[model samples]
Each structure stands twice: as structure tokens, then as C-alpha cells.
Target: MGAPSTELQELIELLNSENPRIIQPACEYFSGLSGTVDGLNFIIAQEDIFKQLMKFCSFENSDIALLALKTITNCAQNENGTYFYMACDKQHFCTKSLFKSFENGDERIIKSSILLIENITRIEAGARHVHAFIEDSKLLESLLKIFVSNKPQYQDLSLIFGNICQVPGVRKLFLKNEGEIFNKMLPFLSHQNASCRLGAANCVKNCCFETDYHQWMLKDDSILAAILLPLAGAEELTDEENDSLPIDVQYLPSDKERESVSDIIVALVQALHKLCSTQMGRDALRKYNVYVILRELDKATIERDGNENMTFEIHNVIQILIGDDAAECDDLNKLEVPPEIEKKLTEMENA
Candidate 1:
């Protein structure tokens, strides 16, 4: 009825890293065969498959075996009269085996363990199940310790933190005290490594999901302002007439350095116009000369043929705060545009 149990026995033989290339091919070939009871039974029956898989887990070589394990667990972890992962009601074999792996395993097992537990927890048949054997308080404490630990830098930490960020409940567990984990992660926002900053941003993004983080990012003129400071030295080094100097030779600091801190200023204003559109956002935006910025940005989003999507959202914010445009200037494009304030004047024309 099935491709003789030899295929299953062969896959189990391929589970160890000593076998090397066999693991992935074994997974691919066995993936199609996992649902068969004869195959799964043979896989579990094979000598040393479980122990080698558990040991190989920490090595990058273990990813395929872990995936295969997760796949087999999912196929076997059903409910309903159907012969699937439903072993929960009929028996606890499938879910219990997964929890045992999580209980008596290293971090290599966490990847599949967390996934299998979440799947079991969310199962229609296992609705009443207490799937997460690791308590939130303990897990958050453990994860935070890793964030500040002096241990080796493993990419696995990034993947784990990234995964935690997606689950709302897990995130609350990580950030419940506000000052607890946040103070630790704050410095990494500008760490020398780009991945650390990106990971920190991702963590911030998750934490500030319900709050207005962009507002917070802009609250201190320092953050965005910082990006422009270096860009100034960039302009002088540009070779217009000749290859005058390297891009931004570090000249002695001067009063002109202040001007260097400045940009078209219109560039960021333009980005913000596309961003802040609601009443609260507009009010928070008004903290800076946000209206003038939006006016400048609206001028920029315009096309050769006409204006862009900003007319509606930008104008909506303008209308809510300042009232309708005066009867004479309601439709802005009709106004004569001056070349000097050509961009600013287009605001009226585009409106």
C-alpha cells in the first residue's frame, strides 16, 4: 500500500549530521511520505534518530532535521475522526512527544518546539489545551537575559527576538515594566552594527505598535537631524567643476557647520506629508513647522501632469485644523507660481 517501509527506515538513517547531505534530501523525499502511519512509525523506530537529531540541533546542519521533526509532529497532531494530528482526543502521544523535546532539549530545539506548541495551542480540537509549557514570566526573563548576556553572538537570538515581537501576548510579557527591557535595548538603536540597529528598530516597532512611534522618533529633533549633519560634508566634496576633494574631507569645525546641519529641509517635510494625516498626528506635527513642511511636500509629490495622492490626505489634515481655503484660493493651481517660491506657491495651485 505504501512505498515499502524501506523509504522510512532510510530517512531515519539520514537524520544525523554524520550523514551530511542526506538530511535535506531525506526531508524533501520523506515530506511526501510523512502522513503515512507506516512511514512515521518507521521513522521513530529507527536507531538513534531522536538522539542524533536533538544533538545536531545546535549546528546549522540541524535545521532540516528540525523542520522534518516539526512537519511530522504537525501531520500527526490533529483532531476529528480524520487520521491526522487529532491524536490529542484519542491519545496524547503527538503533543506529549513534542513537549518532551521542548522540556529536555537545548536552544536548538526551541525553534520547532515553540512552533509545535503554538500549533497545538491554536488547534480547533485542542482549544482547551495548555500548550505553552514555558511560562511567560520565566520566558521573558530568560529572553531578556540573553539580550544582555556576554555570550557568543548567534543569529538565532535575532530570529528568536523577531519571533517574540510578532506575538502580542509575548511582547507584553517582554515589555510589561516599560523601563525593564527598554532601557537595555535603547543603546543598540545606534550600535556600530546595522543588524543591531535594525533589530532594535524591529523591537521598537513591535513595542510601539499601538502608540505613534514616528512621532516619538521625531519628538527630539536629534534623530532625523542627526542623519543630515553628515550629509552636509557630502555636498562640499561633490566634484562639480573638478574632483576637488574626497566626499566630505573633515574640515575644521566652523560656523558654516550649522548650515551643513541643514538640508533642503523640504526633503523630510516631503516624507512627513505622506506620513502624518489625522487630527492627532497633525497636532503632534504642528510641534514643528509641519504645515509649512507639508506645503513644501505637497509641491514635491506633484506629477508633470498633475498632483499626487497627498492632495486628499494632506488637504484633509489642513482642512480639519485650519478650516476651508478662502473662496478665492480654494483651487490652488490657478494661482501664478513664482520661480523663487515656485514650490511653495504650487501648494495653492495644487490645492
Candidate 2:
């Protein structure tokens, strides 16, 4: 990057001005710049501008603070821009400002802060930082309070929870306290917002990797029902099969629809598969007649979108659900993979 242009220097000075008139337009100018690739590149190259933007997030004027946060949010949309925020000293100040925004009594500021954190936590380094921040600030409890209270329009916080839980250390936090925190997140699987549904599904799927939680999770009938309900359609089931399913998914109206998003469907299916890793989980699923739901899902998915991958996943879950009990492993996660199969998986991943 070359030296900051004379015009760019003047803009930076104006951004530091005490007058709201000068500050607002300067923040808006960079906010607009941050929206385009060339502008983002220019902004990212200039440390002074980047620092000023971070500083503006804490500005006394809500409008200027919003513009600054918007600018940072736009910049953090990609990997390079996200890494720039991670590398800067102002990143801590930016993060503190984000949490402080929650108390500023401005819905727009709070949402912008949440959006910025969501963007940042998409990367591993940022996830680690935010995870620590949540732990230290006891932010997770506060977030759950908001969520359980049915607070309107804070669905994006679920995305932040999902992103951070990808880290092993952070995931354990949810699993703590007998998974009370994790359980609170279950209802959102059927939330009206597609983003909320997707985020909740992702969190469930990621946490399911802890096979130890299978028994605890299966104890809550709602968890399995939540995972399966999205896969259930308007198709009528046999009376016996309908009675056997978890209550939430047992009866379907003629116009009942499956989840529209492919990723959410896939996550729910994968979570089901993980739940089946234990014999207890397998028994619970079998008792619920889950295979009947998957059977319909397989056909529906194939007909609706020809999503072969999702179909394959459905088949995998069905295999375990209906497999002979005598031949079942006590814990599927403990089963060793054959060398050839392991090599094939590695090759596929690398390819």
C-alpha cells in the first residue's frame, strides 16, 4: 500500500473531529467505501482508517457508531478482512464496544454489534476470542435469558452460539450444568426464522459429536422430535406408525411442509445419525418409528430437489434405526475404521 493520499488523510482527520457534522459524513463516506471490494481493499490497507472505524463503534452519537459498526461488519465479510480485524490492537476495543452496545438501549446498535460478532466468529481465531469473551462475561447466560424470554428479532445470536460451539473448548460450556444451556436452545429448531432454524440445527449437530451426551439428549423426547419434525411432510403414515412417533411429529396436517433449506435438513439428519451412536439412542429412535419419517424424507427430498447427498444421509440413519439389535455395536463412535476405508475417506477429503 502506498502512502495515504492527501484527501484520505483529511478524511481521517475529519473522522476524529468533535463536531457530529464532520464525524457523521466521514463515517458514512467510509461506510460506503467498506461496501465495495476496491473500497474495502483501500480501507484495509490504511491502518489509520481501520483504527478510526473501530473507534467510531464506541462513539457517543448512535448514528456515527452505527455507521462505523456497519463499516467493520462489511469489512469482516471475507477471510482477508476478518483476519485484518483479528490482527489489529483495536479488535479488543471493538469487541468491548460490541458488548457495550447491548446496554445502549438502541435496537439497531445492538443488532449491528451482534452482526459484527457473528461475522467475526466465522473464523477459528475469532471464534476462540469471542468464546473466551462469552465465558468471561457470562454472556451466554444473558443471551439465553433473552432467547427464552422470546425477545423479538435477536435470532442472529443463535448463529453466534453455533459458530463458537465449533471450538471444542467452547462447546463444553454448553454441555456443562447437565446441558441445561444446551437444552434451552432446542425449541428454536422449529423457529419461524430460517436463520434461527439453521443455527439451532447446526449447534445441535455439532454438540451431538459428544457421544456421552446421547443418553442425556435422548431423555428429552422433544430433542428427537425437533430433529425429525422438519423432515416430516404432509404424507399420511399408518395409524400404528403415527402413534409410535414422538408426539410433536405424530400428526401432520394435509398442508404440513418440510424445512425448505437444504443445509438445515442435512444438519438435522446428521444430528439424528449422531444420536444413534449409542444403543440407548438407537433404541429410543427405533421405538419412535423414526425410520418411517426418514423413508418419506428420502422420497420427498429426491423428488423435490434431487438432493442425493441428503437422500444418502437419510438412508444411513434408516440403516441404523432398523438394523438387527444383536449385531449392533454398543457405541458406534468406538468402532474402528478399516485401513482401506479410512484411506478412502482421507482421499475424498483431500480431493
Candidate 3:
């Protein structure tokens, strides 16, 4: 950290210029600069740089604000810088400035704002700060509005919910939404886009952390069935059903397509592991014969030498559902193996 370079100083001054022309380029320059560690440290070293950048977030011109938000998002890449952004003005970056930018009807600004907030909440300190503002403002509702509108920002909104919902209170608010967030995300388990399914699975995984929420999830057999769909590879997302598959995925030959399916399996297995923590939750899984699905998936994954982490999770969930006794059976996949035979098999193996 030598003394600030003349170029850095000039850019900082140019960012503060009154002319929109100068400001826009300044935003772009800073955006590029924020990409590197040295450049990031330069911006972080500048006094009140974030405070100055906050002014650009609401310049009445969407492009400038978008660039400004981009720079802010880039700064968010560093944990220390994120704390600095969150602390710029007692959380004004989130509360007044960024929230205003979020509502300005600019998709770029909205997306950038979502990413900035997501970065902020990456740590608990920043998460707690944003959570307080979320309780008071229409932040969560605004995110839901964007989501239900089926806008481009919906994926980012899904991720924002995943981060915010890690807070227990916000998660309950999510469950109470009119559409019932659980129901909204459940069908995505069968979505054609693999990332869509992964995002939905991660959010659902966080929701299951709350013990009280378990009943809402477990009470509906249909919910469990729909969730299992992705894991079973039961339904493929056809072009007729969903036209939104990324062009790269849609154009690739069929043989290359199952790559997406493997990612979804990892998310589903991770979610089920979280969902099956309690005895009642385990009972619900058993009622739906989810263990059968898990065993089949486990066998397939082991045979394929698939994702080791996901395969391990599938094994763990099956054990939870069928109990420690299942571990003793000759073939754990046989859900109906008798206790006597299981004991004899274990005795003979141990012998």
C-alpha cells in the first residue's frame, strides 16, 4: 500500500464531477478497477469513496446508477469492503440508497442491487444489518413482486431470498407469503433449467432449518412427491413445457444434457438431508416411500461414480429414514427386508 497513485486520485476526483458524462466513465473505470485486489484496495483506501459513490446510485439516469451499482457490487467482492459498504452511512447503502435504486424500474439497477445486497448478507454482520432494514421496508415484498412478475430479475430474487431467509424471522415471513413460498419453489424441482432447480432447492433447504416449518412441508404428500420428482429424474423439462432453457444447454446434443441433471441431484440430496432432521419429518418421508427413491438414486450414483458428496448425502438420508437397523441388512435398498434376515446377514458378515 504505497501512497495513492496520481491516476487513482484523478479517477476519484472525476467520479465526483458534476457532469454526467464524466461521472459515467468514472463509474465504468471504477467498475473495472474494483475487479483486482490492488485496485480494490485503492478504492477501499480512498476516504469516503463509498459515500461519494452512494450519490450516483440515484442520479435519475439508469445507466449511471447501473454502473455505480456495478462498482459497488464489485467492491462487495471483498469481505472487508462489504463491511465498509454496509457501514458507509449506518446501513444507508442498503436502507435508503440501494432500496431506492431497486424500485427505479431499471432492470440492470434492480439486478445489481440484488447482487450488492446478496454480497452484503454473505456475512452475519452484514446480514443482521440488512435483516433489520428488511423488517421495516418493503424489501422482501418488492423482491416477491419482481419474482411473481416473472421478470429477468427473478433468479437473483430467488438467491436473495435464500440469503435473507437464513434469518429465522424472514424465513417465516417467506412461508406466510400468499403463494406460500414452499409451494412456489416445489415445482421447480421438475424445472428444465438445472440452475433454476438448484436455486429452488437451496432456498427450500434453508426453510427446512426451522423446526416449526416442518409440519407445513410434511403435511402435504403432494409436496413430498413433487420434491422427489427431480431426484428420480421422473420428468424432463420439454421445450413445449419450458422455452427458457439456456441456449447452450438446449442446443447441445442429448448425450451432454444429463450434466445438468447431476447438479440438480446434488441440490435435492442436500435439501432432503436438511428436511429429514426430526422424527416427524422422517415419518413423513417414509410415508411417501422416499427411502425407495433415495436408495435407487444412491445405487445409480454409486454405479456412475457420480458426485461423491451427493452420494454420501443420499446414503445418510436413507439411513435416517430407515433407521440404524437398515445398515445391518444384506441389501439396504430392500425396504421390506425382515429383521430376522437382516440380523442373520449381519451375524454372518461379522463372523
Candidate 4:
């Protein structure tokens, strides 16, 4: 009855079938689509579709139901977050209906709550209202399960945890009372999934302002080599290996690293470039061999950023290090890229 797509309708119809083949692909397709909540809310408003999804969330067939659950959540939480929050707060509407998704023996419903709550938090000043849920402490247990859940739960949980960790009081609770929380999520930094690692990294970065997160990260075995290695040295990069960093460390034309995620990489380059241009981060970079990573990253930007703002920023970094004329050894003493490396960089500029 709502504005409809054949794909959405097709997935909805296929949900009625008991065939595993139909349900599996249907779940995949459902997960892949980001439909308007109007369409999903309209469909759920119907008695039949609501009942079917509820059944799937039950112990009967959670695998299929989890797919529709996230889809519905995505719609409700999309740009119309305020609308959904207002509606959910109403007793008989989406809020009541959503809470019903959580039930005994229903892992899918429980898991889907991560996305739904995340959307709720996006409302203007809406996080304050959602924090009321955390006040109950019941959500904390569910949150931990979702945070640590494997497979499909990983990204969703990381997102929800990321948001939860942002609330000022909530973060303190985890750090002060639940000391093990951040450490539990450390392994996620090296997750095979880039988005997962990126999300987890941002989460860890937040913890840096509290306690000993940066020092802790420096020592953690899982994160140290994978992340710190490139930042610590100018080693060769394979196509796959280079794809890993937020920056393209390979620095070559036609290299193939692609993502629509992790804006933090750009943020890191910009931040480090600024930090390095200063007497402090520059001194730290030189003393710690961090300049090699910056130099290679700068070379990559020569073509990728092409004298763009990012290039100008790196220029500041280079200027500070070599004193605009390779006349300083004070800062370079800490950085060990060798004179030959500097000569090669100068040659590239002239060429």
C-alpha cells in the first residue's frame, strides 16, 4: 500500500516461503537495501507483515527475521530520526512495537536493538532520552553481548557501543566501574572487516582522553604491529597491505585501495601533519622514526591530493622538518629517514 519497489515487495513476499534458499538470499538482499522508513513503517502498519516478522524474530526462524529487523531499524533510524523518536515515545506506536522485538530465545531481536537504539541516539538532543535506557542497567548487559557478539553482530555492536561510549556519564561508567570493557574490544582493531576495525579504532581513540588508553594501545599486541608499524616506519607495501591504512601508503599511480568508510584517515593525516609541523610532534616524529611514514604519505598525496589542501598541509610539515632548505639537523636528529631519502624527495619536486 506504501510507495513500493519490486525488490522490497519481492523480499517481503519471499519471507512467507519456508525454503531455506529463498530465505537466505532474501535476507542478504534485505540487509543490502536501505529503504525509506515510510515504506517499511507502512508495510509494518499492516497486520500481516508485522505478524510475519515477529514470528521470524521468535525462536522459530530468527536468521531470516534478523535481516528484516535491521532493515526496519535502518528505516526508522535514517534521516527521520526525530520523527521515529517522537513516534516511538508514543505508547502504542513504533516504540512499543520495537520493544516487542526483544523476547526470550530471540537473539535476532536482541541483536537488532543495537541499530534501533543507535538511530534513537541521533535525534537532536535525543541522546539524553536514550540515556534513560542505560540508567536502567538492563541495556548494559545486552549492550555487552552485542558488543562482543561475533559475525553479523560485530559492526552493529561496534556502532551501538561507539554511540554509547560517547555519552559523558556512560563512558565514565565503563572506564571506572567496568574496567575490562575497552580491553574486551581491543581485538576488534585488527578485525578482517575494515569498517569494523575503523569503528573499533575510533572507539579506542575516544578512550584515549580517559585513563591510559594511548599507552595501553601502544602495548596491546593485537593493535601495535598492524597500526603502529606503518606509523613507525617506511616499509614496502603490497597492494593488499597498503589497502589497510586509512592513507594509501603505496603512493603509486593506479594503486587500488578503495573505501567509502573511515574519514578518520584523512583526519589523521591532517592532524599529524599539523602536529608534526609544530616543534613538539616534529621533535617526536624525528626522535621516533615517525617521519618516514609521514614522508611516504606525503609522496602518496603528491598525486592523490595534487597540491590540494592536504598537500599544502604536508608542505608545512616538510618545511618545518628541513627548515625550507635542508639546513637544520636539530629536528632531523630524532627522525632517521637518511639524507638519501631527503635528496630523493627534493628530486621529485624538481622533476
Candidate 5:
């Protein structure tokens, strides 16, 4: 693309002006220009403009920092702009600054940074670049610290970490920290915030995709109970049990929030289904009495059946958990030798 206009150049200069009054409007104007990919690409072509954004990303003024982040978030939304940002990010300076914002910037900056990182991770090249920076900076551990503190942004961090785990090598690293990650996430399984609970469930589902995690999960009854609690709804958690719950259980939903409530239920069930593959996992399901919860939920759905596929998935998981024939889960039993090869005639019978 051709050069950015003189007006764009003036606006870029104003972002660096001493006055926050000038910087805020300038950042807003740039963010507006970034509404379309072609507009963002044209702006990205202006290397000075891109570098200025990286500077303002760490502005002492919170409003400037947030606005700059918004502009970057808009740019990060386009794949071409994402590639350009990662490509032009020399010595990993921009990545480091962004993580710094996550660490110290106010709520707006933290949330915007999470969105920017999420947008970047959606592109494979961008994800790999982020993985490399995080590996060098020990950023995962830093995020884990923030998570342990239970900041409100922990919900965003959980979702961001879940997205990062989609990268293969990064997933392996997360698997190493599985215990700590699970310890933090499990409580959120019962969190009052619907988004927090949903993010936790999604992270649990992705982490459990590994065989090693499945083995660990099967052995942890506490986790098994925690995973089933949301799907089982209020009935599984008594008033006495709710009083001592790890987090305050959300009060039953009103009419307006019913859809959000349903979405969280689906997420929890999906996470449970990820656990039903192995015999050990199935045993754990029964040990935790997951079948009872799922059966009740399935029956309720059947009586009021609106969503067919979700009901089918929940039903399927219950069957696998309760099925008598091990062959029903043959896919999970594949490590063993085939029956014909393992079978041998007794010598006495042969005689």
C-alpha cells in the first residue's frame, strides 16, 4: 500500500504530544482509521506510526495507555496487520511492553491487552511469536501469579492462557504446571461470575485433552466433584454445602440471565465429556456420581428438549460412564493387544 496521508502523520505526531488532551483524541482518530483492514494495513506501512504506538502503549497517562492499547487491539484484529506487528517487533520490545501493561496497567489496559493478545494468538505466526516471548520472559509463571492472587482479570488471564495452550509446545509447558493451574481453575468452576466459570471450564477442557492430564484428572476426586457441580446445578450443592463452597455459588438465575446460565452449563458438560474417554476416567465419573447429575440434567432436557445435540452429548457421556462392556470404549482401550492374539488354549484343554 501507499504512504499514510499527511493528516495521518499529523495525528501520529499528536499522540506523542505532552498533553493528554491532544493524545486522547489523536489515539481515537487512529483507532477509527483502523476500523478496516486496508486502513490498518496502510497505517502499519508507516513504520514510525507503528513504533509510536508501541511507545504510547506504555504511556504514564492511563487514558493514553488504554487508548493506545485500543488502537493496537484494532490493528491486531487484522491478520495482515498482526503479521506486520509481529514482523516489525524488533528485539521483542513490543511484546515485552504489552506484557508489562498486563502486569501494571489499570483494568482497562489489562483487559485490552488480553484482547490484543487473543487477537494475535488467533493467527498461527502471531501465536508462535507470543509463545517465544513468553518462554523467554517466564511470562506464564507471571500470569500464574496474577491468577493465584484472584484478580478480577484472572478470568481474562484464564481465557488467554487457554488460547495460548492451543499451540503445541506451549501446551506441553502448561501440562508441566498442570497441578498449579488446576488448583487455581477448579475453584473458579464454582465462581459466581458466569464468564469466570465459563473461562475456567474451557481451560479445563483444553488442558484435559492430554493423556497425562486425563490420568491426573481421573485420580483427583476433588476435581471430579468440582467439575460436575455446575452441571448438576443447585440440587447437588446443598445450602450447608453452598455455605462452605470454595467460592460463593451464584444464586439461581433470573429470566434475563437464563441464556448465560445455559451457556455455562453446556461448557461444564463439554468439559466433562472430555474426561469420559478412558476406563479410569469412567470409573472416576461413577466414583464422583457424575452419572446421577447428568441423568437428572438429561431427563430435564428431554422433558423440555430445545437443544438436541447438547442433549445427545450429555446422554452419550452418561452411557460411556455407565456402560458395562469395556468394548464400548474400545477407542480408549487400543493400547492393549487384540483379543485373538492374547488368547491361548490351556494345555490340559488341548490334550
Candidate 6:
């Protein structure tokens, strides 16, 4: 990085100016700059400007503060930008300002703050920082309070929860206390907004990675049913099959529809696949006749959008459900894979 350009220096001066007119437009200019890779790189190189923007997050003027946050949010969208926010002594500063923004009472500020934190938590190191931040600040309780309220305005908090739960320590919070917090998040899988649904679905999928909790999640929370409900259509099933299915997914209304977003569908399918890792999970899935739901979903998906990856995952779960367990290894989760096959799996995931 080189010295800041004269033009960049002038803009920084305007941003530092106490006048609302100067600072507002300067913040807007930085907003546009921070949105692109080249422009963000420029802003990142200018430590003074970057620090100024972080300070503006708490500006007395709501407009300036919101714009500064929006700019920071844009910068945090990429890995490099997220690292910049988490680097040096600014991590605590950045996270504290974000949590404070939650109480700003301005809808735009709150949403932007959530989005900024969401982007930060996407990176592994950033997630760790946020996990620690939440733990130390005791902010998880407050966040859960907002989440369980089911307030439409704060629906985007689901995204933050989803991303943060990717951390094992943070995930344990939801898993503990008999999964009290985890159960509250399950209803959002069927939220009216696709983003909320996607977030909650991803959260569920992340929690599914813990094999020990499989039986409890399936029985106590009805988690399998919550995830599967979004994948079921109005396709008719026989009375026997319907009765065998989990109640949440049985006897669909004629007007009932499946989740339209491909990503949510994929996440739900992956969660089901994770649940199949253990014997107990497999038994529960088999008991519920989950295959019946996936069979219809597979057909409907192929007919509508023909998402090959989605159908592939659906088929993968279907195979496990219908496989002869007696002839197969008892511990599916512990099965070893050959190097070539593992490499192929990695390539497929990357593709």
C-alpha cells in the first residue's frame, strides 16, 4: 500500500469535519468506495480513515452513524475486509459498537449492524472473535430473548445466530439447557421470509453435526419434522404413509407449497443427511417414513427446477433410509473413506 492519494486525504478531512453536511456526503462517498474490491482496498490502506469510520459508528447524528455502518457493512462482505475489522485492537471496538447499535431504535441502523456482524462471522477467525465477544458480553441471552419473541422486525437476527453457531462453543449454548434455545429457533424454519427460513435452516443443519444430540433433537424438539415440513409439498400420500410420517409433515393442505429457495432446500436436505449419521437417527427417520416426503420432493424438484445437487442430496438421504442396515457397517458416522474418494468429494463440494 502506498500513501493516500490527495483526493483520498481530502475526503478523509471531510469525513472528520464536525459539520453534518460535510460528514454525511463524505460518509456516502466512503459507502460507495467500500463496496468494491479496489475501493475497499484503498480504504483499508488508510488506517486513519478506517479508524474514523469505526468511530463514526457511534456518531451523535443518526444519519452519519448509519452511513458509516453501511460502509463498514459493505467492507465486511469479503474475507479481506472482514479480517481488517477483526485485526489489531479494533475487534472489540467494532463488535461493541454493533451490539450497541441494536438499541439505537433506528430500524436501518439495527439491520445494518446485524448485517455487518453477519458478514464478519462468515470468516472462521471472525466467527471466533464474535463467539468470544458474545460469551464475554453475555449478549447471547439478550439475542435469544429477541429471537424467541418472533418479532418480524428483528427477523434478520436469525442470520447472525446462524453464522455464530458455526463456532462449536457458541453452538454448545443452544445445545445445552436441554436445547431450550435451539427449540425456540426451530419455528423460524417456516418463517414467512426466505432469508429467515434459510438462516434457521442453516442453524439446524449446523447443530445436526453433533451426533450425540441426534436422538434428543429428533424426539424432544421434533427437529426432523421441523426441517422436513419445508420440503414437503401437497402431493398426496396413502393413509398408512401419512400416519407413519411425522405429524408436522403429514396430510399437507392442497394449497401447501415447498420451500422455493434452492439454498434452503439444500440446507434442509443436508441436515437430514447429518441426522442419518447415527443408528438412532436413522431409526427415527425410518420410523417417520421420511423417504415418502423426499420421494415426492425429488420428483417435484426435478420437474420444477431440476437442481442436480439438491436431487443428488435427496437421493443420498433416500439411499440411507432404504438401505439394509443389517448388511452395512453399524457406525455410519465412523466409516472410513479412501483417499481418492475423499478427494473426489472435496472436488465436488468445491465445484
Instruction: List the global CA lDDT of all models.
Output: 0.43, 0.83, 0.66, 0.51, 0.68, 0.82
Give per-residue CA lDDT, model 4, range 1-351, as digits (tens): 354567556757887788867776755554554364445555445444444543443324566656666655665565553354444453334444454554434555666765675676554345555555455555665656655667564366665555555566655555554446666655665566655655555555444434333333333233333333323233465665455443423343443332323343443344344334334444543444444555665665557633455455456555665554233533333456779988976666555
Model 6 residue 97 distance off true place after TM-score fit, in angstroms? 1.2
Candidate 2, which segments miss by more than 4 Å at Cα? 1-4, 89-91, 305-309, 319-351
Regarding lDDT, does 1 or 4 come out ahead?
A: 4
Q: Residue-wise lDDT of candidate 3 within 1-351, one digit each (tens)? A: 444478667877887788888888888877787888887887776655667776787677778887777777788778988777767758464446676665666777777777787777767677677888778536666666666566565566565666666777777776774336567766665555544566666667767776666777776666565566555533244563223322222223433323236655776676676667666676667665677567656766676653666666677788777774333342223357589997975665344
Model 4 spans with C-alpha error above 4 angstroms: 1-72, 90-111, 122-128, 136-142, 149-151, 177-179, 209-261, 264-291, 301-351
Error of 2 at 332 (Å): 4.6
TM-score, candidate number 3: 0.75
Name the lDDT value of residue 210 in candidate 1: 28
**Model 6: what TM-score?**
0.92
Cα lDDT over the full model 5: 0.68
Q: What ranking of all candidate models by TM-score puts the best one first?
A: 6, 2, 3, 5, 4, 1
TM-scores of the candidates are 0.40, 0.86, 0.75, 0.49, 0.71, 0.92
Between candidates 2 and 6, the TM-score winner: 6
Compared with the true structure, what per-residue lDDT tens digits does model 6 show for residues 154-174? Answer: 788888888887888877888
Higher-ranked by TM-score: 1 or 5:
5
How badly does each model clash, as a count of residue pairs? 8, 0, 0, 3, 0, 0
Which of 4 and 5 is the better model by lDDT?
5
For residue 66, model 6's alpha carbon misses the true position, in angstroms, by 1.8
Q: How close is candidate 2 to the true structure, as a TM-score?
A: 0.86
Those runs of model 5 whose alpha carbons end farther than 4 Å from true positions after fitting are: 1-24, 35-48, 78-84, 103-105, 122-127, 136-138, 153-155, 235-263, 299-309, 322-351
Itemize residue pairs with steric clashes in candidate 5: none
The predicted structure with the larger lDDT, 3 or 5, is 5
lDDT score at residue 219, model 4, on the 0-100 scale: 34
For residues 1-351, what per-residue lDDT tens digits would candidate 2 score against the true structure? 243578877998898789999999999888998888888887888778888889889788899999999999998887788888877743477787787777777788888988998899888788887776667537778877775666555778888888888787766778888887888788888888877888788888889888877887888677888788888999988899999999999879999988889888988999999888888888899988889999988887876655766776787789888777546468888878899998985665344
Candidate 4: worst-modelled 10 consecutive residues by lDDT: 224-233
